[model samples]
Target: MQKAVQLEVYGRVQGVGFRWMTKLVADKLGIKGTVANQADGSVKIIAIGESATLQQFIGAVKASPSPSGHVTKLIQTELADVSLCRKFSVVG
Candidate 1:
């Protein structure tokens, strides 16, 4: 089944290549979405993909993108009727 989710990731996520890593993982998992940095020093990810693949993507993201980065918390919200994109991107 296909699904969509909006995730607000907190802790040491900014300025640490978290968005880039998210994009890489999303792409590898054949997921499409966007990752952006929030002014509150958090990373926001909107992903759409297979139910199982999305879970895997979330796990990979929680692992922290870079050694210098740490994922203190991850808040995920299931989204309905979200705009679907063709690829994953690191947006501002």
Candidate 2:
């Protein structure tokens, strides 16, 4: 089933190529939506795709691209549908 997940990834996430890493995973999983840096020094992602795909993407986030940007937390929730995304983007 399709699921929409809102993720808040913490730990030295900003200015660390986090969004690009997220985009790589999302694109590889065929997921779509957006990823960006929050003012609180975390990364936020709104990803929509199959439930299985979402899980896989999350796994990658936990493993982050940089060793320093450890994923301290991940918050996820389901949206009603995937009718809003055009493509995965790194929005400010």
In terms of lDDT, which candidate is strongest? 1
Off by over 4 Å in 1: none
Task: Give each model's clash number.
Answer: 0, 0
CA lDDT, every model vs. true structure: 0.88, 0.84
Where does candidate 2 stray beyond 4 Å? none
**Model 2: lDDT of residue 6:** 86
Question: Candidate 1, residue 23: CA error in Å?
Answer: 0.8
Per-residue lDDT for 1-92 in model 2, tens only? 87888888888788778888789878888999999888888888888888888889888888885655677787777777677797899999
TM-score for each candidate, following the candidate numbering: 0.94, 0.90
Best by TM-score: 1
lDDT of candidate model 1 versus the reference:
0.88
What's the TM for model 2?
0.90
